[model samples]
Target: MSTESLGHNSVDARSNGLFGVYVHWPFCAAKCPYCDFNSHVHRGAFDEAHYVEAYAQELAHFAKHTQGRVVQSVFFGGGTPSLMDPRSVGGILDAIAKHWIVDPKAEITLEANPTSVEADRFRGYRAAGVNRVSLGVQSLREGPLAELGRKHTVDEAIAAVRLAQSIFPRTSFDLIYARPRQTLDEWQDELTEALWIAQGHLSLYQLTIEMGTRYYDLFRAGKLKMPDEDLSADFYEMTQEMTQKAGLPAYEISNHARPGQESRHNLIYWRYGEYVGVGPGAHGRLLINNQRHATATEKLPFEWEKRVHARGHGMVTDDVLTWEEEGDELLVMGLRLREGIDPARFAKLSGRKISDRQINELKAIGFVETLPNGFIRVTDKGWPVLDAVVADLAA
Candidate 1:
């Protein structure tokens, strides 16, 4: 089979937007203190075969609603999708092909952790039709890695990245910044190393404390000291400057990619295109019977499987969205891109145009700028306060 072509072209992306499938693998070896995602750590025996069957069944159920739509991307996200046997991954892909007309050029990605054990599966994943790998190499320093509860050493992380680059057509890694006690110079050095080793894409995120996590409890107890707002702003600005200088500009608030090497799967979400989320604790948006519906499944792994076996799918929520809600979602998601939102598209979805008064107010303050093509984008000056800008426009 021919490998999917790689290029960073927005026209092709927009023209080909279709269904993106997100399959969640919710098991992890250990849970990170800062994570609030719906992931669980199972020390007992795992049943990969059983979960594979459940995924196939749920996908078949979704196919009935999304018939005739060509699939443009498939992403395996996880507590640890890398932990699954490659054969299982292949089985899921085969099931997807059975139900949908998967575009030959569709991008297939799997999220992995940078550890030797996981690295050992790189070739297996490649054989299973995964053309892209996103590594969770959160930091390059040992102290921070230990603090973050990551099992991999910095050396192991780098080695895994090298091994992944050798096997995958596209590679990307994630880094968490604004960490406690991290100096700006230290972060600069770390980022320099990251850029030196980076391939086509990188996801740089600032650490945020979420409720119901260990970090949140520690923070509430005043044990975890994160960067202050002023310092975090400095870190954000420096990141933009470094990444832009390295020729990998910010395509979204937290993602940097070589012009066409952007993750097509993620783009579907940011662009508000339809997607089907399968497996445990996954969420999806789809056009069902001419109405946009939001869907979510049971988060517990075994429970989800039982639900699927009993009722064809494990979905617990399937609320149809109002046009006003769709417009709000469009505004919230589209503004994250550097390319910004098309007012015409927004008007089409919302039935009301964005207030000219708000646009002028934002433009006058240098928070936003209008392109020659008429799309309105948040300025570099405006990105730090993106939420406020979107809320203003949406209001």
Candidate 2:
């Protein structure tokens, strides 16, 4: 469908509501020891043009199912989306605009590494319609940078951030705290520097050893030193206090942003909005035939490409969620936001109300509280045990 014809339809597929498109680029220059994401390092050259074509076909395939939706955001996430040629990025975007009525003010973001080479393309990405950039600057310390398998130096990371801020309308960078033997004082100093460099957004994540990563193997072998439970709690509290004081408060548990600078693409996921995922290994939540369905694509890159060419899409799973499953997912995602969940919405999704006895018991222990407007949220005291709180409420 042409953009003009698509625009003429006033029915929004879900207009007045949140909808998004996520494009996953699964190639990375190198894999980090701590990451378990679906990323690969190709030893030889591959056809970038062919892959871009697959992405376009997949977008068209989804467009047929979600016709007339006004896309509120488009995110180019990856193993490393910055590695993509600017023309490829532009091609994928053109395909998106071809199939749907992309909102004029839609937030378009790309995730990039902080290498100088990638930073040089910031202007090109901007020219191609990407208005936001999120850099993977895991650390500012030289020692930790090496330990984390990051190729960029601290100086290079800072330079990239500065360059991105100058080029993009919005920018954000990530930092991983709670590293081995990281003192509270050192983190305070480092984060202070980061806030000074930050223009509007920061994603501060605590280090955790997930299975299938090198860090997990090291931890199992007792070769890795992790902070004890108490120290980790101290780190979390310090992070909350410092970012809140910097006016970039934690809108979600791991993401902090200046008012109105929050990542709109990510908000779609956390707020339980529908989105279509394109590309290998991407997962999506979509509203189909008035039912919420969970969809996933093949994880292997070449296999996914072959499937896309064979059947016009690479989707391997599309399960319709039960009402109870919908309620559970809403809690799993919505509770991550400081704004919390609506009891009425939960009842509507689940066909049953959350147990009042559970809420009262948790509140008695200072784990949760009802807002002045009747929204229920986990208190700071409860954030450390958020999973338990959600489980109790959902049960």
TM-score winner: 2
Kindly report which residue pairs in candidate 2 clash with one another: none
| Local distance difference test, candidate 1 | 0.91
Worst lDDT 10-window in candidate 1: 1-10
Residues 1-395 of candidate 2 have per-residue lDDT tens digits of 12322223324332227889999999999999999999999878999998899999999888877777889999999899999999899999999999999999999999999999999998999999999999999999999999999999999999999999999999999999999889999999999999999989999999999999999999999999999999999999999999999999999989999999999999999888889999999998877556676889999999999999998899998887899998998899988889998888888878899999999999999999999989899999998899999999999
Model 2 ranges off by over 4 Å? 1-16
TM-scores for every candidate against the unseen true structure: 0.95, 0.96
In order, candidate lDDTs are 0.91, 0.91
Write down the worst ten-residue block by lDDT for model 2. 1-10
